[model samples]
Target: MADEIKNTENQELDWDSPISKDAGEFEIPPIGEYTFTVANLEKTMSKSGNKMADLTISLDVNGQAYVRHDYLVLTSNMAWKLASFFECIGLKEKGQELTHMPWDKVPGARGRCKIIHEDYNGRPTVRIDRYLPLTGSAPAQATAATAPANDMPFEV
Candidate 1:
């Protein structure tokens, strides 16, 4: 009986079977400017115990779906990025002081952002170049900011 049970178990496992035979590779979108909406935002701690805000922005390219995430470290110098992002969506103006705004109010903000295709650890990854203001007419593609050379000391 034990031998029969072991045979049944072996038959249930198919080492040669594929989980998804029809699965195809996902194509990365070309680098360019695209309209994006702040789909979600969350506050978390960085590896060094620093407070950071993660923003998940959604991109719709010719009906194709894509997502770009950005992190804002809550430091005096790094705070400008967060302010610039708010300004891009018309929430704040240039040189305007940021008030006590709740992080939960970040979602639903719409703006234009530049997307760049980059190689991360030999893998293709999409990154947000920069955020542009939402004007009556689409503004020119903003310049891509230089990313840090080293990997961030935290995981999403």
Candidate 2:
């Protein structure tokens, strides 16, 4: 099994990739060049054709699978959620003008941020300080800041 967030040691997760961003006080993760890869769409196979309970995805960076969750998403909803994030922040989509591309190995979200993962008191949080890219102008110099309304580190 892969190491959990709390158990993993901090290392040079993004050392080789060259990063680029505007030369102003841009937001933290909203700016910066990072390398990322999305997991290919997969079907949970079982002899019993019962509906799946959740979707499992393996998010990676240069073949390094950093995060994995079972049964959280598996249909168009998850794909749309991730795609909308890419569209919202003005990141490059895999297939331009082709609309509604499949969600396999697409250029997944990239940007290092002090991520706060939840809204309630029991929400999880994390800070990704790597080649995380930010959208918008350079004035958004990234730093420790509170998550915006209706989002707790949903910037992915």
Candidate 3:
């Protein structure tokens, strides 16, 4: 089922809300003017609920910020819409080497769209960081060589 999304990169959005108007034709941003991209999307549905997904989107655009953590968490369908938008922005799928981020999730009936805000400088900037993942290096190797294996009995 997910393959449908993983296949082709080109796709259209139903865009059922008014909020998308400002985003639809967003300029690609001048070469060095600014760099924006949806970084990661995460969704979790209550095991007992009627398929309601709680979502948190992280972004890595411009400097760094998360406009909204609870941006909108409704249903799987809506979640994909937000995910697709990010994909189109080149942030979700920039490349495999530099960074790897998850997808954002949204609810079915996300109310009228509006710009999410985050405190950046003295101004209220959008929280694009919500779509990004925390970046850090792997742990270092132990100072000693290969240590002795555990004696506990536990077959593979």
Candidate 4:
């Protein structure tokens, strides 16, 4: 025997009451590096039917909550972001490939990320500039010790 869920009546919302507009307003934090934790990872399909990983990073600045969304497409061209994400979380090395890596373990990972504010269509939006591994982590040590001799220009 199984228990059945009971349907309840829907309550009406009071639209005529005065609402505080300031309660919903939030100011974007300054563009700089900040510590963030991976709050959630959502795997979904893109519009073109390609696999996509949506990362939700939560940041605490002066006791305020801020969130940034990063989308990683599992494609050759866009895979670097995924790699960077792993490196940021101290999970992968530079120039290393982990095709069979377990992505289910990404939540709760902590790192620092550079954030930039950009104006999109007259609205201010926060964008993740780059991700950096936390100090004393393996990936951070590797990045510091084995930095490329020549500064190569690349975009992520």
Best by TM-score: 4
Ranking by lDDT: 4, 1, 2, 3
- Compute the lDDT for candidate 2: 0.35
The models' CA-based lDDT, in order, is 0.69, 0.35, 0.33, 0.70
List the candidates' TM-scores in order. 0.68, 0.28, 0.24, 0.69
Give the distance in Å from residue 122's predicted Cα in candidate 3 to where it truly belongs: 18
Task: Write one digit per residue (lDDT tens) for candidate 3, span 23-138.
Answer: 22222211221223223334556565543433332322343432234333455556554454344333344233314233332221112122344445554444322232212431
Q: How far is 26's C-alpha from truth in model 1 (Å)?
A: 2.2
For candidate 3, the lDDT comes to 0.33
Clashes of 1: 0
Worst 10 residues of 2 by lDDT: 25-34
Candidate 4's displacement at residue 58, Å, is: 0.2
* lDDT (Cα, tens digit) per residue for candidate 1, span 25-144: 456678998887677788998787889887877786776556667888888877777777877776777776878545765787678888887777677777787887667743333343
Q: lDDT by residue for model 2 over 9-97, one digit each (tens)?
A: 44554778665635432112222233333333344643454333222223333344444333323355556444443443345343544
What is the C-alpha local distance difference test score of candidate 1?
0.69
TM-score of model 4 vs. true structure: 0.69
- Misplaced by over 4 Å in model 2 are 1-80, 86-98, 107-114, 119-156
Stretches of candidate 3 exceeding 4 Å from the true structure:
1-40, 46-55, 59-62, 70-156
